[model samples]
Target chain A: MISLFLDTSSKKLVVILVKDKEIIGKKELESINDHSSYLVPFIKELLDLNNIKTNDINKIFVVNGPGSFTGTRIGVTVGKVLAFSNNIPVIPVSSLKQYIFSLENYDYYVSIIKDKNNRMYYGIYDKDYNDIVVDKYQTKDVFLKDINDLKNVVFISEEEIDGIDTIKPILNINKLIDYYKDKEINAHYLKPNYLKKIDAEDKL
Target chain B: MNEYKLTTRCEEDTISIAENLEAEKFPGMVICLNGELGSGKTVFTKGFAAALGISETITSPTFNIIKEYLNGEMPLYHMDIYRLEDNPESTGLLDYFDKDGVVIIEWANMIEDYLPEERLDVYFKVIEEDKRIIKFIPHGQKYEELCEDAL
Candidate 1:
């Protein structure tokens, strides 16, 4: 069985192709404000490079936000369209979860994505990647205070944070697929998890 | 008053400072913001609001003068005094100082006379598109401690 992975929640666009638990091909592109224009073509190229056609993909996995609004939408939309058209199962993964899955063995894991104005999209997971803390937007100070006394904790983020032991996360597609194997949802129900409300939706 | 200066190379640094400030937020706390347009006054307020547990989107209350958000850990009084340059005195505005909420006033220099004597004043200077020089002036011991805790 062939599986496809797409991640466009950040400035980076990452695509991965896996055949029976083995990664056949992977491609990453770092571009700002250009996800919509490049995502489809990139995915097509990645599939072509691996000698796999779109119809051969049995399942699709996508990082469904807590990052850029437009980027998340573009990735999710592509994933949904591809999955629905091919009648394949699609798994929507959280960017924070992906970050945690990419980490090594640790007692406690904190994954963060810096949003506008110092607010962070953060998640805390246990050794088995279970949620010890829920995903939400918080100031760096509040987040630090929450985890300040924690023992054997490791932090993963794309940006350098002060007063904490932090490292950049290395995304692992195979781990993500293995972790979310049975949690596939209908493509229609898949939506971006933007913890922070957009400006247009603020006035309710 | 004791003054502290910090130069931020990007918006993330400014937000980190704001988040640290939010960790030390208290009732009746007043933060006066002074900076030119696009100097990140609203960005600082957004960081503070998120720390207070506000999930709602925060925008500059430029047209409304004062927008109150009570959904957070404590009430947040976000005010933009830019439009009040000519007439800074409004009776309702005085009520906010003692509302037992965290009040952050942007373009606060316009309404200097009406401000409390004991407050934290922050002045932002745009050094580059993403760089900023932020000056913190703490007028009281409590505010000084707040600066120490946050910065």
Candidate 2:
């Protein structure tokens, strides 16, 4: 079975094609401004590079986000369209969850994405992969105040925050596919995971 | 909302007012400047950036949309929202406010709905040649104190 993983929730764009337990073709680039333009072409390039056809993709792993509003939409939309058209199982992975997917040794892991002024999408996961602290959009101040009381907490994020030494998350498509294989949703039900409400969405 | 008024007899007076505000500057300070063209809006911004020790020639960000000066005492995110009035994309704009920088938005009234609840607004009114009436309306407690100290 062939698995395709796509993450475009931030400045970094990741496209990985995994065959069985091994990752075959992976492309990670900083396609800063335009995610929509780069996503499909990169998918096609990875498939062509691996000598696989579009119909060979059996499953799709898409990072739905509490991230850049436009970037999140582009990724989720593409994932939905591909899954629907090709009859593949699409799994919606949390961008925050992806930050700590590989850090199971730690008793606790804190994943945060700074979304706006002093506001962030924060989640805490236990060694069992349970969301000990339910994912929510809140001020960094609130998270810091609560974290002061915890022990052996590892912070994972894309940006290096002050005072808190953060571990940069490395996306491993093979590991991610193996872990979230059963968490599949119908493509029609997939939507951008915006933890906070957007101004335009409110108007609609 | 707290409001104050000031009159600048010349461009130097406007510069001094900006300098006084700079004295009270802090990280994440949001200042909104509004006025007609050549109404000393750019003059005030140049004065503020100069006071922040930004030596690079300050040009209006009208064409660039947003100009970032990171070498200053604190980062200065100079933005022109006039062109972005009709644009619906505002994803990364609010992120600058948390960069621990002073965000100065020109033609700020264009996106008043998106502005932070805590900010200072400066309105420039042309009264006569070489003279301008500047009105300061501050929101939130910190901005109210900023006007009390600077205006």
Q: What does candidate 2's lDDT look like per residue over B1-151, in tens digits? A: 6679899999999999999999999988999999999999889989999999999988999988889998889889999887775443444675566557899999998887668878999999999999999999998889999888887
Chain B alone, model 1: TM-score? Answer: 0.95
Q: Is the docking of candidate 2 incorrect, acceptable, medium or high quality?
A: incorrect
Which candidate wins on TM-score?
Answer: 2
Tens digit of per-residue lDDT, candidate 1, span A1-204: 899899988778888889998888887887444678888888898798888888899889989977766678889999999999989899988888797777767899899876534567888888998888877677666777668777888999888876666899887777878888889999999998766632232223
- Give me the overall lDDT of model 1: 0.83
Error of 2 at A92 (Å): 1.1
Residue A57 error, candidate 1, Å = 0.7
TM-scores for all predictions: 0.57, 0.66
lDDT of 2 by residue, A43-104 (tens): 99999888998878999999888676777888899999999999999999888888676776
Residue B92, candidate 1: C-alpha displacement in angstroms: 34
* Residue range with the least summed lDDT across 10 consecutive positions in model 1 chain A: A195-204
